[model samples]
Target: MNIFLVPYTRWRHLAMALWCGGFGLMAWWLVLALTVVGGPKWAPEWDGPILLGTIAAFVSGGSILGEDNLRRTPILKRLLRGVIAVVIAVANTLIWYWLLQLVIPKLLPDAWSADAADASLVSLRYRVGDFLAGGLATGIACAFVRKFDHVVSHVAGGISSALAAGAAWYLLGSNFQGLTDLYLSGAALGLVWGFLFGLITWPIPDSLYTGWIRVLSAVRFGRRIPVDAPDGGPKERFVGHFPRGLDLFLPADQGVAEMHVSVAVDGRGRYAARGLSLAPTRVKRFLERVDIRYDPRRPAPLETALSSGDRILLGEGEHQAELEFIMLPKEEM
Candidate 1:
């Protein structure tokens, strides 16, 4: 249970943690405000520490990497990373809050609670308690659930976990009415935020690499461009290019005999290029990062295999596109 075992540099990890807080705060308020306006009077206000905790566990491929690590770990040693993250998220967030209070008191005083001015240890205890309560309840709720698929699925889990936590707090004769809203808003927003964040950072991994044949030299939008250029966007090729559809329309590269080359991105993130064109599609592979080598004159038959940093020439002359095999890494998947 080495809680401090982070693989990355401290500053960068802390930066990302603080970056996560921006989205977390948004998630907390959006749910609370939406529920308060249209729903029951007893709904809970945003649970700040819980929001931070949940964000820390899940964002930016952290949870996915964690899950993979857990699976690779021996069965007896597996622990709930989500739970541990809850503590870390709260601790880090509170530290950030403390700094904000000290550094920007006159300008950002409204951001801090009255408790922020209280004795340091007491403030820490309150925040820690706030995180633990939600963390335990959310972890329990999530354990009984499966991975989220649809947007509604996120909403459901949020409500369920919030209610579960809120009920516990209510029985303690704390704010019972507040728990009602807390349960609903927290559940709904948690799911929604997770879903949105996934899209924002579509982390495509190196292993499950969906590759593309990028144009290194091309004549497009009016000029003969020479040099490998980045694509307009990532093309997740379920089906490689053809004349009809599911492709990038390469009309200029007539040297590419229609259906010039067929590419299949394999399971291990490798791209296998087979020559579909009657004309030999030259698959020039770069050797030792210096020399260029040919792949069997290729590709009037299956010839080239391209990984990261590899290149291909689909056609000759005006229709020529100097192509590269491009892949998004595991972190960006």
Candidate 2:
């Protein structure tokens, strides 16, 4: 019923909801009580709701989704996803809360005037609307999670979070009345939640891997390729013209395709690569040209088991692209 239901909400959230919600609620009330009892009046009482809400949102929002998809994901990649999820969730919650504040008063003016009518009480109608709006907006935010390496996915998350918040705010009529107040409160909540989640989830960059590609050209460029692959998994990849996709690139003059060759793991977990090049891909060594037997019927693609120091030249003519596989031991790596 809460925003928790938005992202493929299944039985997965029930226990988490109970556990996190209970601690979060208690944590929130404690902060409020302590602040009001002895702390300075300058301290905001809403801090309780923000902290409590952040726990429910953070753990439930990004953390839960990440758990669902953690299979085969590298640690660093997982950290990035969690950070993105937390930020988006927090943005959605704050936006929904602020907007509900403005809208409730407008839709049911009678309720507002009567509550405002009492002069001594805040309207319960607004509270109900705020709760509903928060849940709905949270759901909307959770739907945007995507693959972390994707540039567009991150951009979409940020844009969607901002827009979802705005839409919720507009619905609540937060724009006209107390917009400044809502912005200030929302900004504070976002920063606080963002900082806390960052520390708890992704304290370090634990998923990145580095490797140097020895390019075979006149001035051989040692292009650095950072590969993120699970251990014992096939080093699946493609190599071609830009040399970028090859896990190593080649010179443009060779007329290499975007994916000139394919290297994939076999059923036995051994790697095999064959030239997918439309142009001649036979090479003697690092960059030397070799006249390999050509079978015009199938382009004579040679699929062979690969290992450390396997050198193959791709392409024919004056200048052939060179490819060298350098396997570093885990300790050296």
Candidate 3:
């Protein structure tokens, strides 16, 4: 059988591998610390949260790194900033978990360990609980670490695989269990469990994630105002290229005045308008406000439309008006 060590380019794969390895080791260490220093009695029960929090911190750090890189920030400076951000995240997690531990004793009396003797059953149940709790914690963490979702997912998968392998080794012992037998059994069980778990908790769609980011960006930076048309009529229509599934980002109060506006349909498709128009330059400035989407499949200069109410007229035209517009790339619109 052919083995595919890494799928992406060498540099990319190396960077990803290093990031994952570093983060995975951090997670392992955190788990170990919780068990060893935090007290094993509580460790077994809190293992999921500790590991999940560690993963969250890694992802949050990676996201900060990625965002800095995307904004054309210097690599060395970005790296330093990311490291600082990660340290803060780690400290936050530790504090949060510590507080949770304090609160748990007051809330639930039996939120801790079970002294069951059936080794296999206990491990199996603990594993299942860990998987569920870890997955949930990871999902929540993903919300904060949106930029590094792909990397985080890959790292999480790798760590989970390693843990499974360790469990299998413990189960089979040193007896010359055929390597092939071990691999097949392990692979099968992993697949079954993964599939079952995935079915139970469906993942968030890519579009929804992007939409949330866009909404958050808008809230942070404020909305874009477009340039008005020459005739002084309200610039009721907005047209722009936006990422698919981001239509949710469009405000609901701003009705879709029209569908398939001629400007958008002429050559490149344009997203319809909804909001107000300010100045053309302001529109351009607003467009640059955030990384709306990251899709390589589409073209450049994505467009965004504005309503007549939003338009700030520069000059009137016989039929044409100077309107503020954001040219979004086909990929990001």
Candidate 4:
């Protein structure tokens, strides 16, 4: 669904940000508290970025695999997927941060050398470095965690995260002198980044052009099946009772056929539902509100275009499958 148009979505967006932000604040506080005990000599400078990147990785990764829509997936599979996403996100983030540390100094040598430039100039350069590192790391990490393989989705995610990092650095740059200051800065940056991430990603076109099919019948009520393909190619999800190749698996009862209908999303993000069997497949179009039935017994099978909120009835009895086509607002996918 286009979540932004729903009344509850705003609150959901805020709740997501607050949850991530709270974790960010807690992480920052714990890291700062650790500094008071006096760690290894080289640890102080690296701790904040490391913790920030780690928490941001969790936030980004969690948003994908932990989505409400994916709840129907097996618990073990979901946990495994979540762990994999974490590993990739954290590893990618750390690698990018390390690269930035190595490259930024070389690119802005004057920023690192106190004797070569004014202290303010050096501070400004370091801030710039922070901005670039934070932005690029988070952006690239998000791309790694997302499911779909779309250039627009990747670029949008990267740019949104980069913007979040830049804004965070800009807002909280001046207060890094002491542990308390560092904690405050880190917490604020995390909070700001979470909100900005949500703001940019929640309503953008990259988030909205995809959708899923939800089973509303008694047999498989509340089952959500994704309609889009990862590679942006047309992938038909077969609906049937045979089980092995079907996307929307249904029990073999009443009038359901083996290969009932096929649903797919084209490259341009349009949805099409095609009848595959001689079963009574019907569609109640969203715009017209008219009931249209597809007769697979015809010489040429026909496919009907679907819009958000379109309803499809696979049969006419108690065993019939009621499917609702819902357009999704883009997030991680």
Candidate closest to the true structure, highest lDDT: 4
Residues 242-326, candidate 3: write the lDDT tens digits.
3242222232222212121111221122233322222121222333422222133555433444321222222113311223333
lDDT score, candidate 3, position 42 = 55
Q: Give the runs in model 2 whose Cα sits over 4 Å from its true position.
A: 1-53, 65-72, 114-125, 146-333
Please write out the lDDT profile of model 2 over residues 49-164, one tens digit for every residue: 35434543653354334444323356676666656656765676667666655565566657454452232332333244444444443344444554334334333433333233
TM-score: the better of candidates 1 and 4: 4
lDDT of 4 by residue, 46-94 (tens): 6535665665565555444434332345667766765665666566666
Whichever of 2 and 4 has more TM-score, that candidate is: 4
| Residue range with the least summed lDDT across 10 consecutive positions in model 2 | 203-212
lDDT of each: 0.41, 0.45, 0.36, 0.59
TM agreement with the true structure for every prediction: 0.32, 0.33, 0.31, 0.49
At residue 310, give the lDDT of candidate 4.
Answer: 82
TM-score ranking, high to low:
4, 2, 1, 3
Off by over 4 Å in 4: 1-23, 36-42, 68-71, 109-124, 151-159, 162-166, 169-183, 202-333
What's the residue-level lDDT of 82 in candidate 1?
A: 43
RMSD of 4: 9.6
